[model samples]
Target: MIRGIRGATTADRDDEKEILLSTESLLKEMILHNNISAENVASVFISATHDITSVFPAKALRGFEEWKYVPVMCMQELDVPHGLSRCIRVMIHYNTSTHQSDIKHIYMKNAVSLRPDLKK
Candidate 1:
């Protein structure tokens, strides 16, 4: 079986390091909670709001020694009016035995408010 783990984080500022660290933390939580393994990962797609252009969040994940070879991509999120700013979101596609309802989704910092139902 396969499932997707969704997570989101917000940057306190427009700095590249902030974006990278926040995204890394959020993705780490998602992966840990879901027990996702490198071999099971199909791909990871990341998107940042227009206000975040410092760097691609996926690049930070790729730099990690454990995930250096994982397939990941980053893109700009849809610029909808009044949308959240400085936010990085990720969708990890992976093969898993867990059910969708059992999957954990992480939303951190200000992004937590965006998905209150999943906040922990």
Candidate 2:
């Protein structure tokens, strides 16, 4: 079965370095929490708030050679009133036997406020 894992993290700024680091940090945490391997990931959808224009979060995802075969897409999040800024959100679809309730969704840094229920 295909399961979806969600994760979000806030970047210090729109700078490339900060965005890249923030994205990588979030991905690492999600991978660790969910006990997931890149080979099992079918695709990843990443979106960043409009404030984040320095770089595409998917660029950071590609930093790992393991993602060479993974289908990853990046998009700009709709700017909603009072939405978190400089936030990168990702939904990873993977084939796994784990139940949806067993999937660990990660929310780190200021992005934790976005998903209080999933916050660690």
Candidate 3:
């Protein structure tokens, strides 16, 4: 079965380094939470709020060879009236045997406020 795992995080600043580090941290958490290995990932979709133009969050994942074949695409989130700034959100699709509700979704830093209903 193909399941989607979601994760989001915010960078302290729009600097490339900050974006990369924050995203890498967020992805790592999601990977750990879901007990996901690179081979299980089908693809990852990343969206960053308009303010985060310094770097592509997907590049952060490429730093590790594990993600080399894990097709990733990064896009800009729509600008909303009160949307959070400098945020990076990811949805990872994986072919897994786990049930949908069993998947762990991660939200960290300032992005946590976006989904107060989820387990942080």
TM per candidate: 0.94, 0.96, 0.96
Residue 100's lDDT within candidate 3 is 86
> What Cα-based lDDT does every candidate model obtain?
0.87, 0.91, 0.92
Model 3 steric clash pairs:
none
lDDT of 3 by residue, 1-120 (tens): 889999999999999999999999999999998999899889999999999888899999999887898899999999999999898999999989998888889999998898888774
In candidate 3, what residue range of length 10 has the lowest lDDT sum?
A: 111-120
Encode model 1's per-residue lDDT on 1-120: one tens digit a residue: 768889898999999889889988998898888888888888899999999877878877876677777789889999999889898999999898887888899888888888898765
Against the correct fold, how does model 2 do in TM-score?
Answer: 0.96
- Please identify which of the two predictions, 1 or 2, would achieve the higher lDDT against the true structure: 2
lDDT of 1: 0.87
Indicate the worst ten consecutive residues by lDDT in candidate 1: 60-69
Relative to the unseen true structure, what is the C-alpha lDDT of residue 107 in candidate 2, on a scale of 0 to 100? Answer: 91
**Cα lDDT of model 3 overall?**
0.92
